[model samples]
Target: MARQVQFDQLGGPEVLTVREVEIAPPASGEVLIRVEAIGVNRAEVMFREGSYFLQPAFPSTLGYEAAGTVEALGEGVTHLAAGDPVGVVPAFSMNDYGTYGDHVVVPASAVVPRPPGITAVTAAAVWMAYITAYGALIDEGGLKPGDHVLVTAAAGGVGLAAIQTARRIGAVAVATTRSPDKKQALLDAGAAHVVVTDEEDLPTRVREITSGEGVRLAFDPIAGPGVDTLAEAIAAGGKLLVYGALDPRPTPLPNAALYPDLSTSMFTMFRVTAAPERLRRAVAFVNAGLSDGSLAPVVDRTFDLDDVAEAHRYMESNAQTGKIVMTVSHAPDAS
Candidate 1:
């Protein structure tokens, strides 16, 4: 049996519970993994609250990212063997599979071999953030060298990943945070300039940073009433790629009459995963960044499997600057 997190009714962090579940053998095309570290994401929180893109069935398991060792493989699976280190990417639906457990059965296609020199914790942290940023900023937004890009809510895992990705592509990254506490951290993480939304005007700072011309692209996850401010910061003919609905309010588009060249679209990792060739390229790019120390997965804190509820509460508080990971402790085998 393995310990896993599940919620019968969706509401708040209190709804999640850890329980012992039977570890079933993987079926065909599935791989059984002994989870080492689980990466907590905002998506999971949204799903738990019954507001995510995918609705939850009663008693649903919740997770999308983890790093672990292959314990068993199903029929027709030959590429990976038992004991191989791997990372779980956000390539599958949480309704079908969940990584918040001591053991998980996931489609083999969703697993990637862990890059060398990266710890299990770091491997669990990188896939979702890097892939989401890569898909939005580079694959869909067409970010280019010398272009300026604005990243909103730029202190979370995905936001920091966007900053690093922009720097990796030789683009100027203008990051925004609600407070000044994370200003230096964002700068250290490759942001060309930092804007405190609570103190400075977002559009005015962006214009000054870009020397009167607005940013060429804006990557935003906080889509709500604040989106209009982001829209005002975009250059004419620029695009706003929004991938998350962190805000509960409706996202309004720029007035067509005033900014005819402004374009806006939604981005999700699902679109990138739909294309096999594009997914391969994204993986290669992230691997290269990890190898060269250009992309670093910052781990904010770790909790044991038993303290998952507290972990969820902490995540909901939004105090973490980077990834919140849960470490699993396995029982000793009695041979």
Candidate 2:
């Protein structure tokens, strides 16, 4: 029997349950992975809380990103072999086939080889975060060289990835944080400038920094009333990517603040992973960056599996410095 986190109800982290389950061998085009490291995202939280676009049936598995070694390959799966290290982007649905488990079965197409030089934890964290950022920054927003970017909730998983993407895309990254303590953490994570949103006038300061030209893009994950800050800071014809509403309140928009309308688009990793071509492109892009040493996933902390509840609580408390990963079988020997 394999163990996994499943939720029978929609609510807080307490709704998540680790239970033993039976799984059949992989079918054609599928592979079974012995999951190692799992990346926790805001989407999983949203899914858990029943606030996401996808409604949950009782007793559904909960997770989206993970890295592991292939345990078994199903018929017609020729591209991979057992024992191959792989990264999973499990955005297909909220069903039993998720990354937060001891073993998971997925289509071969949903699995990408973990980059050669990257660790399992980092590779697990990379798939969803990097792809989400790429789809929004490159494909949707058309982020270009010399464009300035402002990111809200800039210290979280996808938030950190957005900052790295901005750097690679030749954009100036100005990241925001509600936590006064994470100010330095943001700078260390490749942000060109850090704005502690709760402490400063975000729009005014952003305008001052860009000399009134404003940022070309604002990547907002925490879409609450705070979105107004980013909306006001965008340059004319800029894009505002609203990916997540971590805050419970509806996002604010200062309607009359800008002359030309600020271009805004809804972004989600689920959407990024919806089509096969998009998934392929994202895997190629992130893998290439990994191969060349240009991209890296930041894992702030790792916890043992039984401590999963603690990890969830820590995440909700917002004290993490970077990605908070959960290690199942193979954690680095701390000694």
Candidate 3:
């Protein structure tokens, strides 16, 4: 039996529960892993509350990222072996397989060997955030060196990853947040400038930072009426990439009367993960960065696997400056 997190209905963090259940062996094209650490994301909270694009089946499993050692490999899976350190990518559907448990069986394609020198916690935190940022800024936005790109909600995992990814590509990263206390931390995270939205006007400040030309690209997660402000902040012919819906309200397109040259797109990491060639390039890019120390995963805090509900609560609190990780412990006789 393996301890796994599950929820039978839509609700808050309190809905999450841990249960010991029989684990299935790896099926063909799948591999079983003994999970050591798990990354917590805001998407899981949306999934639990029934607000995500993908809804859950009753008693649904919940997770997308994990790092562990391989325990077994199914037929046709020859690239990995027992005891290999590995990490789970968020390429597969959560309804099909989840990494919330101490042991999980996932598709062979979604498992990648952990790079040397990265711990389980760091490995668990890397893929989702970096890939999401990479897909939006590089793949979709066509971000280039010397160009300015805006990263909103700049304290979260993906936000910090976006800053690092931009810096790695030589682009100028302009970050935004609602709190003044996080300003210096965002600057320390490699952002060229930090905008505390609560204290300043976003468009005006962005214009000042860009010397009136405005940023070439703006990546945002809070989609709502505020999109107009972001739209106003972009240079003519620039693009706005909206990747999330943290605001939970209606979003509006910019008035053609104001900025007809502006372009907007809704982005998701699946754009890269769902495409074979894109996924390959993205993996190669991130691996090279990790191996060279150009990219680093930031883990803000950790919780015991049994305290997953609390982890979810913390994520919802919006106080975390980086990725929140959950550590899984296997008692000698529990597995």
Candidate 4:
């Protein structure tokens, strides 16, 4: 038996519980992994609260990123073998698969060889944040060098990833956060300028930073009344990629007459994996960034698997500047 996290009902972090579960052999095209670390994301929290795009079934597991070693392989799987280190990508639906467990079975296609020189904790943290940013900024936004890109909520995992991605592409990354304490951290994370939203005007700061021209692109996860603010900060013909709703309020549509040339698009990782070729390109890009040290996983803290609920509580507190991870204690037989 292996320990796994599950929730009987949709609710707060307290709804999650860890229980021992029997491990089953992988079926065709599946790989059984002895999970080493799990990456906690905002998406899981939203799913638990019954506010996410993916609906949760009662007695359901919740997670999308993890790293582990291959303990067993199923029929027709030849790319990996026992003891191979791998990271689980957030390319599948959470309702169909989950990574918050001592062992998990996932499609072989969703597993990528863990990048070298990083711990399992770092590997678990990389895929969801980096891949999501790659899809939104590079694949969807068509970001180019010297362009100014505004990243809202620039202290979370995906926000930091967007900042790094923009810098790697030679674009100016302007980061925003409500807290002044995170200003230096955002700057250290590759943000060209950090805007304290609570103290400064977003659109005005952006306009001044770009020398009266607004940002060429805006990557925002916070949607709501803030949509208008983002719309105002964008340049003519600029694109705004909305990937998440951190605000619980309904997203208000941008004023078309105010900025007719501004295009607003919703982005999700699903768009990156919708095409096999596109998925391949994204993976290659992330791997290259990791190798060159341009892309690094920022881990705020780690908890044992048993303390996952506490990890979730910490995540909800909005005090984290990077990824929160849960480490699984390996069994005696686990490699």
Candidate 5:
């Protein structure tokens, strides 16, 4: 029997129920996946809480990206076959593949050839954060080499991806985290400097680190009321990108400092992934980046498929340094 994590009604992590679901064979241009690992993201947390872009239907399947072996191929599908290793990114919605399941059917566009060097757990976690970072920084933010990127929420998934991507392009990386503990870890991920904003002053610390030149780009996901400090610290004519407001409060832009000339770009990946070709490019970009060693999604910890509630709780705590993941296989025996 094919089993998956589902919620008859959306509310919290506890609402997720893992049970058997009937499997349908692939249609034209789709392929079936045997899930090895699934990524648990804060986006999943937001989806469960009904704050994400899409609302949950009763008994909706959960998960956006995963990786596994190919089980079957649909007609007209090229470059993939049964028994191949691949990453499954469920563009559009989780119902596209219901990747939390043991098996799923996904469009060819949603799949990428997962190289042997990358584990399923790492492959599943890399796509979303990396693609979102690539789109926001290079495609949208117009980041250039020698640019200084100040990334908020530096220990989180996007922050981790941003650090590696910035380093890949030869840009200076400055990452921030609430926990003073993850500072060194961020540096280990190739950050030029790691800022523990909860411990250090934001503007003053950024200025000190940048030697008062200020950063050329600020990639902010935490848009709390205090983000004016970020706006205050942005170097003249630099860009600011706010991808989300994880904080309950809204960011306040002081009019005096909020110059019309300041470039600020905002977006949701859901909107960007709508184009089938772009989705394919996202898959290609991440897969190539991983294969080349320039990008690797950090896996903080992996829980069993049955332990999704604990995974959600852990992610909700915001203490994890990188991607928190779930695997269909059993959790590793403790030491």
Candidate 6:
């Protein structure tokens, strides 16, 4: 039996429980992986709370990112063999496959070889954050060198990834966070400027930073009344991409009356992964960034597989500056 995380009810972190369950071999177009590390994302919290885009069935497993060595390959899977180190992308739906287990089965299309010199923990953290950022800022926003981009919630994994991805493209990344304490850390993480939202007005600070102009794109996860502030901070003809709903409050629509030139839309990483050519471009772009040291996965903390609930609590606390990774330990399969 393989140890996997599951929750029968929709609720908080306490609802999650680890259990030993039989894992079947991969079927056609699938690959079985012995998970070494799992990346914790805010989506899982929303999923467990029954607030995500996809709802879960009872006793469902939840996960998106994982890194490990391939243990078995299903029929027609010709590219990978057993013992190859790899990472699983968040391309598949959580309801269809999960990686929060010592051993997990995932679609072959979701598997990518881990680049040399990156540890499993780091590998586990890369895809979701970087790909999400790339899809929004690069693919969708059309970010260019010397252009300014606003990155809100600058301490989370995706926030940090957006900063790095912007810098990698020669654009300026302006990071925003409510905590003044994280300012220096965000600056050190490649953000050209840091905006403390609690102390400073977002639009004023962004305007000052841009010398009376505004950022070409504002990448935000928190969608509520605060979106009006972001709309004001965006330049005319720019875009405001909202990729997540960290705030459950109702969002206000302020574009038509205030900033008609500004365009706003919701984004997800699946938009890039769903298209084959786009996925190929995203993977190649991210791999090149990783190989060249332009995009580095910053792991803020780690927890044992059994401490998943605590990890979830930590993520919900918003105390982390980057990715929270879960280390998995495997035992010899008796089968």
Q: Which lDDT tens digits does candidate 4 get at residues 1-335?
A: 77899999988888999999887899999999999999999999999999898799878998999999999999999999999989988878888889999999998888888767778998988888998898999888899999999999999999999999999999999999999999999999999999999999999999999998999999999888789989999999999999888887989779887889988988988777666788888888888888899999799999999998899999999999999999999757566
Model 6 deviation from the true structure expressed as Cα RMSD, one decimal place: 1.5
Tens-digit lDDT track of model 6 for 108-178: 99998888888999999999999999999999989999999999998999999999999998999999999
| Tens-digit lDDT track of model 5 for 1-335 | 57888887768789888887887788999888988998887778888888887787767887888889998999999888888988866475754446777787777877878886899888889877888887787767778899889999888888899899888888999888888788899999999988788788888888887789778889888787656778766788888888888887866653454654467656667554767676666666677778888888899999998898899999998888889888886335498
Candidate 1 structure quality by residue, lDDT tens digits, 1-335: 88999999988888889998997899999999999999999899889998898999878998999999999999999989999999988888889999999999999988888888888899989988999999899988999999999999999999999999999989999999998999999998899999999999999999999988899999998888777888889999899998888888888876777678898998998887767788888889998999899999888999987887888899999899989999999878899
Q: What does each candidate score in C-alpha RMSD? A: 1.1, 3.1, 1.4, 1.4, 3.5, 1.5
lDDT of 2: 0.82
* Candidate 2 residue spans exceeding 4 A from truth: 252-258, 330-335
| C-alpha positional error of residue 215 in candidate 6 after TM-score superposition, expressed in Å | 0.5
The C-alpha stretches of model 4 lying farther than 4 A from their native spots are none
TM-score between model 4 and native = 0.97
Better of 1 and 5 by lDDT: 1
Candidate-wise lDDT, in order: 0.91, 0.82, 0.93, 0.91, 0.81, 0.93
Task: Estimate, for each residue in 135-181, the C-alpha lDDT of model 3 and write its tens digit.
Answer: 99998899999999999999999999999999999999999999999
Clashes of 1: 0
True lDDT of residue 80, candidate 5: 87
Candidate 1, residue 164: the lDDT equals 93
